[model samples]
Target chain A: MATGEVKVLGSWSSPYVMRARIALHIKSVNYKFIEEKLSEGKSELLLKSNPVYKKIPVLIHGDKPVNESLIIIQYIDDTWPSAPSILPSDPYERAVARFWAAYLDEKWFPSVTSVGIADEEEAKKAGISQMEEGLALMEEAFGKCSKGKGFFGGDEIGFLDIAFGSFLGWLRVTEKINGIGLIDEAKTPALVSWAERFCSHAAVKDVMPDFDKLTEFGKMLFPKIRALAGTR
Target chain B: MATGEVKVLGSWSSPYVMRARIALHIKSVNYKFIEEKLSEGKSELLLKSNPVYKKIPVLIHGDKPVNESLIIIQYIDDTWPSAPSILPSDPYERAVARFWAAYLDEKWFPSVTSVGIADEEEAKKAGISQMEEGLALMEEAFGKCSKGKGFFGGDEIGFLDIAFGSFLGWLRVTEKINGIGLIDEAKTPALVSWAERFCSHAAVKDVMPDFDKLTEFGKMLFPKIRALAGTR
Candidate 1:
């Protein structure tokens, strides 16, 4: 049983996890979602599957494990080359899309982590500033990448859109917890609009976790992160 | 009149810049390399070409610009398919290669930057520790990926090897500046051997900048970076 099946080992709350799920859904691929409780020791399967990262969102397709949410999406795109292409056909456009996705993965995610954990008065300020800087870069990059286009790749929701789309769900929670409005109408109207459009897509909407549950989870997790940061 | 010609806008000492150069050389691509003095105001062409990053290693292939060293390499590989393949053809192997390349880009690069700037008292300890950690990870990953093979993929040197190869060049200089030794014969022996084999490759040996000059440049950069960090 489960041989040659597509299995995703992930947690319900991880934004990176959501990315893989969204990609799978968009591509209309059938897969089993195995929710892992990361607080406990990771399962042996998870460890063996992704020994390098030893983290969640490990997409095992036909017995081969692909770690890294963005990479997994690329693997899916490559494996299922059909309608709803997640990346552009043109190499130049593909590079731009990948650059933004990489930017989001590297820059934006760190800020989210900082904000999630920052506690000291000064440290909190630094965290907020970092978050704002990430948002500003995202806004600027999105503006350039989405000139006169609906989606990041124009007329289609590609990998860049899907990659960033996963973060929006978590960002909303982060904004609420931090009491700071990023992606506001004044600050990042285009990004806000894109987030709205992205979340509205049937593929995205169908797999998205309950927002209220996520916010509640964030509320619980934020304090623990802050407490850990204090020890550091 | 260099119409439709390839131009690389980069600084002389940058590892990222060297990545682009190596890719071009390996692919036998004919291009003009424009060295930018980053201390001064960046050149108009560099800024215009990569308006977002406004940094070095902007590869102007024909009429299009590709920023980000890894992205540029991917573009180069795509453009020159018949030449030496940078990435592995197999999907799983390619994903593993991309993962390590990203690990270097996201994790190792930042640690190396911090090492360059940290104060003397803190730098030696923290920098050495960070370097060792990164090296350990690299060694483990490489050992698993290499699987008794000569190179990362097999007999042929591939993308993973090339990406790690560029880092090793800078790492040597950085270690020398910091008065520490990484990739020694005893510790991380596999990686050290890998580095030795990698550096000996015709492609790498031909394109790699002179180590003596790089060391001299590192000596100059270290003080400036330390002074800047002191202020911050």
Candidate 2:
């Protein structure tokens, strides 16, 4: 049940790219990582593969190209429907997973990403406040979704895990840049432990970038992130 | 096999709400449509159901609430799974459907909505330009997706059909408000025909709000839509 010529067109430091790579890793699917040199400009392959958005993390399977990180993850799960299922089998659980994943991408990640790069001190504080509020909600969600297990996907690192887990590197980078503790022991006890288990897990151990490296990466991208933040 | 109560928490004029309702109709599921008076502020039930977004078109199946229009549509398809699938069975096609649906929601819809309500002439022209650009891309997509068939689903209504079809009402409203045609016969002849076919289809015919009613509704919400446009 092996796939033929699976490739991921992405840059090294993107959390979105990590989601696709992590999903591939979890499914035990071997894929070639074709890094896009986005600083120079998007690779011709990336532009051709994803013409509409012209964005990174395009999953090239055979000749078909899948765009968007979440869609790519779902595609991998659907294409390789075997052991180590990414999304839950139950209809309701799958819906819940999709709901939370959307929240992480659409709401939570932006708040966290804004904290370190925002221009005004007031904006940074507001970003931190929003990040904390989002964390509290995620904390409650973890309790409900995990059902007393160690991970959001229960024992295994499933959809929600890869989703929120992908941001762990960026989260760490944010914390290092701001000198703050986001996943606090007092506020989110379960997530504090869950983050440790997720990063060290066999599938994710080497996949997540080093904290210091990501912090340096974050510093370099500060002007660019700030410029782009307003556009979003 | 109908087991329990189904209720839709929605405002009648909303395109997103139409998506949930149309998906239900396609499945022949009888459900109560509870009109939320959103102008008076959100109801307690709506807030409780979707605490994060605090937004509408929540599909309450028995007591469980599914938030977000796209998620609700997917949830409905997953829960029913019997006849007339909303999303395609094939994974690749499903991914493509999700991709276009995301594009419509995140990119195209915003462009079209802005054209009529933008405060300045420059902004309005920009909106029209973006709208045409999006329509051109969608026209190309419709050709590839429909594949010489009457609909995107090829003889049946499906995920992309529901996604784009929901917006036809709003597109018409935008046209009426701006006194300009967004879906041009010369530029987007496929979409022009598809819109007619979609509006006349049984599942969509009764579900889409009347054009005049929606036009009046848009006028009433001009100030509100303009205010929210900047935030997004």
User: What TM-score results for chain B in every one of the models?
Assistant: 0.91, 0.94
Tens digits of per-residue lDDT for model 2 on B108-227? 998877776789999999988998898898888888888899888777889899999898888888888888987878789999889889999999898889888888888888878778
RMSD of 1: 3.6
lDDT of 1 at A83: 80
After the best TM-score superposition of candidate 2, give how far the Cα of residue B209 lies from its true spot, in angstroms. Answer: 0.6
Return the clash pairs for model 2, or none. none
Give the number of the best model, judged by DockQ: 2
> Model 2: per-residue lDDT, tens digit, A1-232?
2247999998778889999999999889898999888658888888899999999889999889999999999999999889899998877778889999999999999898778688999999999999999899989999999999998898899999999999999888888888898898999999999999999998888778988888888898987878887799
When summed lDDT is taken over every stretch of 10 residues in candidate 2 chain B, the lowest stretch is B1-10
Q: Positional deviation of A19 in candidate 2, in angstroms? A: 0.7
Show where candidate 1 strays beyond 4 Å.
A1-3, A39-41, A112-149, A177-181, A184-189, B1-3, B39-41, B109-126, B143-149, B174-181, B184-193
Residue B21, model 2: Cα distance from true site in angstroms: 0.7
TM-scores across all candidates?
A: 0.87, 0.96
lDDT of 2: 0.88
Name the best candidate (by TM-score).
2
